[model samples]
Target: MELKAISDDEKQRYKTVVLKFLEDLSYNLDDKAIINYINKLKKEFAPKTARMHIIRIRAFLKFIDHPIANLIELPKVPKRRRRLVIKVEHVRDLLREIDEKLSGPYRLKLKSAVLLSATSGLRAEELYKLRLEDIDLENRTIFVRAEIAKDYEDRVTFFSKEAQDVLEEYLNTFKPSNPLFSKKSLLHQFSKLDTRLRMKHMRKFFSQQSDRLGMPTAVKKILMGHSTAGDVDLSHYDFQDEEELKKIYDEYWKNFRILG
Candidate 1:
């Protein structure tokens, strides 16, 4: 049952075949004969969308105890990557595409949400889950607890000057302590407005600004609260020097640049 213990042949004959079987089952049994088809639906879509379907099918196979039920090959699909850092100019185009004709609270909410996620690297879920207390205006940082971050690691996110300005406006003027975007779902509501703002797009927007600002990759990763790539364990040291994290976080904010 451990992955390392499974022989290559067993993986091929059992795991690979099991995956194909589940795909065939989901596809063939679909009521419309194309109802649950991923390939049919994903011509221009990211492969990860299709991969999610595969994951659902895998979960179903496990639940049902089908052939090769205990084994599954990891499906090869494109990952939904975060955006590379760029400047505000690139995001300006996207903002134009949005309901630019609209202004005031709705506009502020949209811009603030997008900018915070882009600059601070908050996940869409984290944005939704963020509390008023999470943002420290005096410190110009956003703290994500272990429960909210993608990884279990805790990190404080720094904000750009413009981001701080907009957030301050949002915090001081409207929806002071409420959810930044109070809808059940941002994309869902935007769907009605004919503007679907996805997490991927938000990251892409962030990356463009970050890239333009000439942010270092390491800083980007750190701001995003991702675990570093190398074998070095900064977490261990941070654990011992918990107070140091706040210092580092504040230092990072001290150098942050905002866009016009």
Candidate 2:
């Protein structure tokens, strides 16, 4: 592998997992050793986490062209029974909780993050990697750069005015030079919240609200930076026009707006 597209945190995770595997198992990369290590992982970690560890280990083995790579089997993980649906009320309640629990620059940072992610459907990594230049307050648009984007493609997406207001306040207060938010610090503060709500759920909220407001599926997918590789309409249709996208987002803003 090519790792240029992987985020720093992802690379670190892969490194940590591989190192742990080497430390716990034999230095010699053998099929038996790998299987034993995976079994130990299943015993020590949750099913999904164990599955992830195996995936990382398998990637490393394949990178070195080990014959055992093809023989390794991933442990089964239980599928989710239902998808978590986020609503405007949940976001409102969370923001109220944040206000009651936090203050100063930290409060504004988290507020801006939650609102932006909720409105723009940005991934946590994408939100963390955003820079001052990537945001256009006047237009209420965000530019997801190719390097930071999950799909490794550049895309412009719009945010609600409610998000824009808080974001503008945050910028004026902190005036960051680059890399608008610290991923470590942001995640640390977010963990302090008492709710089970997560940053990823904010994106889900945006998707849910967009569908509820009658946004075209292809347009919604484009806004979320999803790949059009297999989609017939998205792959062949011209839905990349920034102005047109902004107009559609504006039309649905009333229903999608999370705050006044």
Off by over 4 Å in 2: 1-4, 7-50, 59-67, 235-237, 254-256
| Residue 172 displacement in candidate 1 (angstroms) | 2.1
Q: Find the 10 residues in a row with the least total lDDT in model 1.
A: 29-38
lDDT of 2 by residue, 1-260 (tens): 34466657789999999998887775877777877778888999998999899999999989899998888888899998987788789999899888988888889988999999998899988998898889889999899999888878999998888888888898898876567776877778778889778777889998998898888878888889888888998765445578977887788872356655
Error of 1 at 250 (Å): 8.0
RMSD values, in order shown = 8.9, 3.1
TM-score of each: 0.62, 0.82
For model 1, the local distance difference test gives: 0.60
Query: All candidates' lDDT scores?
Result: 0.60, 0.84
Q: Which numbered prediction scores highest in lDDT against the true structure?
A: 2
**Model 2: how far residue 79 lies from native, Å:** 3.4
Query: Residue 218 error for model 2, in Å?
Result: 1.2
Model 2 TM-score is 0.82
- For 1-260, candidate 1 gives per-residue lDDT tens digits of 34445546555555554466446666454334333343443563456655555555555556666554345444468556764454455566545544454466666666677767766777777788788888887666788877777887777776666667877887777765556665464564355444444555666655555555555555556667677756255444334332554454444444554443
Alpha carbon lDDT of residue 233, candidate 2?
85
